[model samples]
Target: MQGLMQDWPLTVDKILDHAKAWHGGREIVSRSVEGPIVRTTYAEIHERAKRVSNALLGLGILPGDRVATLAWNTGRHIEAWYGIMGMGAVCHTLNPRLFAEQLVYIINHADDRIIITDLTFVPVLASIRDQIPGVKHIIVLSDEAHLDGSLPGALAYETLVENASADISWGGFDENTAAGLCYTSGTTGNPKGVLYSHRSNFLHTLVTMGSDVLGIKATDTVLPVVPMFHANAWGLTFSAPAVGAKLVMPGPKLDGASVHELLETEGVTFSAAVPTVWQMLLTHLRTSKGTLSTLKRVVIGGSAVPEAIVRGFRDEYGVDVTHAWGMTETSPLGTQATPNYAISQMDAEQQLQFKLKQGRAPLGIELKLVDDDDKPLPHDGTTFGRLKVAGPFVVGEYFRAEGGKILDQDGFFDTGDVATLDEHGVMQITDRAKDVIKSGGEWISSIEIENIAAGHPKAELAAVIGVVHPKWDERPLLLVKLKTGEAATKDEFLQFLDGKIAKWWMPDDVVFVDEIPLGATGKIDKKLIRERMKDYVLPPAAGVASGAVALAAPPEPKIYAPEPEPEPVVEPGHEDDAWLHWTPDAAQSVDRSRREAPAAPADHVEAPADAQLPFRGR
Candidate 1:
């Protein structure tokens, strides 16, 4: 017999409603695209959001219709989000960083009806207006006076909402109704939408609030430097209000100076963003000797965090750094590196080693590693396998079934990541399955090499890609974007890694480039890199790595070879792509006789600028 429990649906609107009633004075400070900071309380946001719903309804928006938002993180943008989702409409967040063609494709594919965007993106929407005929209204998130007449027939978001009435009801539908749509960065072939249900999003919000998860508290002041379009700002939009935490939304400038200014002036206690933003911030801090006096904690994601970053934040700034790992498909918060009780008791340095790995699954999620043939693999910490995730918040299938039947019979979704989970349940991502370099029947982790190379003092940003080799099938190629005004020879870098990594894992060449372009999600554009370096060929196996200049003709390939081992059991995984279509080089015949030489163990945006809107609790 079923127990008697309240049948209250877990709609997202309840989070806002509860915030309005209990924490009505909680602030949502925003750096506006127009200059000044806009401060609005949860109570005001609640009322204005209701007005947004009425305005959308008057414009022919119905429940289940798709309303797209292409704007930066701000109070108005959040209002638009709640306004759209509160009325049972799907809020589709469009990444402005994406190409115009991609925007066209996504808007057309999702059949987005209304485009609510910031003034910054008005030109972008205007350029693609003809391509996306499905978008009926262009609601500019600004006052009516700010209209420059660039985009004809555009509605001012402020005036539209101000003219509407808030006497309307919300949430009379099922909790499982679709609430938000976020497309993947499309690192592979095409961007696929991950449709989230109100039930799943609500449950995910609750999961993120756990002590071992985001650990966001009502007393915390949050600065979500990660864009709102990025996996719903990693689900902070809902959880902040759910827990009554104050939010600070950075407008459009994500440069180092602006972010540092906001962190200092606004008294931000906690913040989250990708590694690139932190790098820029750390650079600015080092140059200017800036400080994050009020900032206590930080969440780093989007890509692997460099060792220098963790050290810079924790060692220099006296801040806590938590490495987060997740994908759009998992409501964006699969696992965070927050140490559990057992690991947390250790000293700071000792705990950092554990913190570097993606922490164990939270209460609701389960993680497992599997080999080829879908067989279970051991969690021995050293062995790498395809990572699979099973959780309530993870996506069951992509929208429109672009990649059909992704989930296994047991209901686990393949994360396309190669990882190692230790006996203590700590998960460390080694590389993408498709990006792993296969040489002589064995796999080499480019991420491992890239991380080591990035630790160099002169190195700023680093990437490792496999290139065709005559004997070993595929060998690694190192690409470095050196820190400004810093220079180092190829010999210094290779010598730095001589004792720290396996000799066989060393790159065949090191190309120093002026810049490394980040993808829409701030990840290394490996696809673009491969395209740019497609014509580059590896030097002879016996010679030293080919740097920008030869530097010197070092010793031949006399590195010691380890004992021959059997090949790892791995299958060809989902396409490893970023931004553009890339054809991976096929593995050649393995020369099993040659073993890899092992060596000693080694160590190791779109937010606003001055756009730093500070926040304080009432």
Candidate 2:
């Protein structure tokens, strides 16, 4: 029998409503795209968001219409997000870092009716003006004074909000109505969109705000260096308001100095960003002799966290570096490295080992390890298998069914990741399913080798990929981007990994370069790296001794081929096996999207990292 309940739908608009009512005075700070720091209260932002909704309505936007935003993490951006979602319109966040072609593809695929963008993206939109045929109107997130008429017939965001009335009601539709749209980075293939419903996004916010996840409090000052366009700024956009926390939006300048200034000036107690951003912060602090006075915890993700970063924050600055693992799918909070009771009781060294692994998922999500044939694998901490996940927040299928039938027979979605699950429910990603190297008929983890090499003192960044070898099927090659003014020999780096990883997994060659490419999501971008290093030849005596000579080239290994046929379509006759059609009613019953990589060894447990950071005192 169904129990007696209030039947209150969990829509995202209520989050801002609750924030306005109970935490009206809470400040939402932002480094404006123009120049100064802008401040507004939750109540003010709430009213402004309503006005934005009315303005969107005046522009002919209706419920379920897609309103695109190509802006950064600012107060105005937040207003645009809420205004779109609260009015039952879909807020499709566009990644500014993506190429013109990619942006055009995404904007057209989404069929975005209107675009609310920052001034920085005006040129981008202008360049792609002829490409995105679906964009109806362009609204710049600026004021009248900032308008230069660079793009004629563009609307000013502030003027629109100021002129529009705030009398329209919000959120009358079903809770499962489409709320937001975020697309993957498409490192291997054309990007696919992840359509989020109000119910799933609301549920994700609650689960992310739990003590073991984000766990932010009202009194905390949260800074999101991760942009609003990136999987909902990793969900900080909603969580901050839901918990009444003060949000410090770091506009577009994510450089170390700018971020440090915000952390200090705003007294930010907690911040979340990718590893590269944190590394920059640490570098700026080291060079400038700056300190993090009020910063407490830093959540690092988007890629594996190097040991240097873990040590740089905790041992030097006394800030905890919380590693996280998720993709554009899973509402981007699949698993976090927050310590549980058993892990908390372990020694500091043991705890470090667990922390390095992508920690267990919280309630409302489930993880599984399976072999090649889709058979379940044991959580014995050593066996590598494909990672699959199932949950309300995980994507039931990609938007438009781009990748067709991602879920298996049991409805578990394959994450395209190879991982090992420990007995304590900890999971460590060994490599991307497409990245694990096959050498001498054995799988060599490029992630594990890259992680160890990156931990070297002089190394700034590192990437490992399989290369051609006559003796073995394929051999691992290490590419290093050393820190500024830092020099190292090949022997020094290879020796640094001595005894740390298996001998078979040792990189055959070390190539130094000035810079390593990072993707729009702040990942290493191995796909690009392989293309750049296509000419490098591995030394014949590689991994045997120092000063190995170059080997004769063999037929280039077939590994890392441009992601073959990633998009599989269903035949016209196979309607029964086709993905469920997306109707409003079908969408109400459906919730969840798909798709990351990580590093570390299985048999070995690492001790505490070196505490001697280049920075000053904690």
Using lDDT as the measure, which candidate wins?
Answer: 1
lDDT per residue (tens digit) for residues 291-339 in model 2? 9999998887777788888988889899988877887778777788888
What value of lDDT does candidate 1 attain over all alpha carbons?
0.78
Instruction: Put down candidate 1 lDDT per residue, 1-618, tens digits, no spaces.
Output: 998999999999999999999999999998898979889999999999999999999999999999999888899998999999999999999877666677888999999999999888787788779999988999999998999999999999989998999988989899999999988767677889889999999999999898788899999999998877888888899999998999998887677888888888778998988877888899899999787899999888877787778988888999998887888888878788878778878898888887767777887788989998888899898888999989888899989898899999899999888889987788888888878899887888888788778889898878899988888899988877676566666667788779877998878777665455556676766765665566778877544544441111011111111123244322244122121222222111212112321111000122311110010000
Per-model tally of clashing residue pairs: 3, 4
lDDT per model, in order?
Answer: 0.78, 0.78
Model 2 score (lDDT): 0.78
Q: What range of 10 consecutive residues in model 1 has the weakest lDDT sum?
A: 609-618
Per-model TM-score versus the true fold:
0.88, 0.88
For each of the candidates, the C-alpha root-mean-square deviation to the true structure, in angstroms, is: 11.6, 12.9
Candidate 1 RMSD computed on C-alpha atoms after optimal superposition onto the true structure: 11.6
